[model samples]
Target: MTAQTAHAAPSTTAIATDTAGHGTRRKVLWGAQILLAAFLLIGSGLPKLVGQADAVETFDLIGWGQWFRYVTGVIEVTGAIGLLIPRLAGLAATGLIGLMAGAILTQILVIDPAWSALPAAFAIVFATIAYDRRTETRQVLRSLKR
Candidate 1:
């Protein structure tokens, strides 16, 4: 082959390098995000759902009482499941964040000010998931396109 023809094909080394770089970056990002999501889901989400645990005490302190804790627990469990499923990730983030937002506001307005820290923790976790799911959020928005 002529010199020009030889140069036309991409080098195998370059292609492999690009592919490896992309794969590694993807793995790192997915690892961090999935770990964060799982922590919030398992640590905060499931226990709240089952009601055997007493993180529900925090809600009770916020004046939600036993009945309200059960209701919030149900919503949290559903939202956690939604966060795990890719298609529903955006909605999950929104729901979880909304829940946290209400908790934060209540802590500020109705509950003791010290209790505000608890909802802030939830907000941080919810925000992390929401930021990580930006691509999914965009896909959700794009689906509304004509």
Candidate 2:
């Protein structure tokens, strides 16, 4: 075989291997996102919906009333569901980032200082997910513009 042909074969194989690795990484990330969504829905959303003691206390601290708690709960649940859908995950993550930002601000300004980091961490995670899915988000926005 020609020397050039031998070099070209390895280059093509490397590219194929690199693409497969990327696909595996993407699947792992997608799985993690799904798990996060499920946790948010079950752990946070349900408690608020049911008026759990801690959730009630948190709303009291926010001073926004029970109605606001219900609204926030609904938003969380909806966002969590949206996160499971490939096409909507970016939008869902964006919405979660807003919610987490509010939580972080509240923790810093009104609630306990030690708790602020929790929401900040969640905000970072949501931001990462949003960044990763930016292309899908752009496509969604483009469709809406039409």
Candidate 3:
């Protein structure tokens, strides 16, 4: 006499279908994040890089000089590119969050309190992205630990 029990594993077809759905959702979210990054790069980063009058004036008001403007512009451009990369998106968002926080503080103390709202909104957006991609960020950190 023999006793046997059968355990059923998930079908490959079902697993593939579930994975496809997740991929589609991720693609949509990535597209939206890239679009927002493009806007930030073009609208804010470009002006700072080119020494646009307003950007220069704002940096002057911040008392950080033109060098700071260039540095911030470079960081913004880099972060924008990083946002398009799946492995780097969360880290990019984290950096942008810091940048936007500084912008918000600058607006409140040096510029105008009313001007802070835009940067505050940007910070929130970056935070959302970072939180959403936290798993990827943790993976990156773990890899770096080695």
* Candidate 3 structure quality by residue, lDDT tens digits, 51-135: 9999999899899889999999999999999898889999999999999999899889999999899889878878878887999
Clash totals in order: 0, 0, 0
Q: Choose the strongest candidate by lDDT.
A: 3
Clashing pairs in 3: none
Candidate 1 vs 3: which has more TM-score: 3
Tens-digit lDDT track of model 1 for 38-131: 7656776667767755666677676657777767767777776776677676668777778888877887897667887876876676676667
Q: What number of backbone clashes does candidate 2 have, counting pairs of residues 3 or more apart or in separate chains? A: 0
CA lDDT of each candidate? 0.72, 0.87, 0.88
What is the lDDT ranking, best to worst? 3, 2, 1
lDDT of 1: 0.72
Clashing pairs in 1: none
**Candidate 3: misplaced stretches above 4 Å?**
1-28
Q: Candidates sorted by TM-score, descending order?
A: 2, 3, 1
Residue 123 Cα positional deviation in candidate 2, in Å, after optimal superposition:
1.5
Q: What would you estimate as the lDDT of candidate 2?
A: 0.87
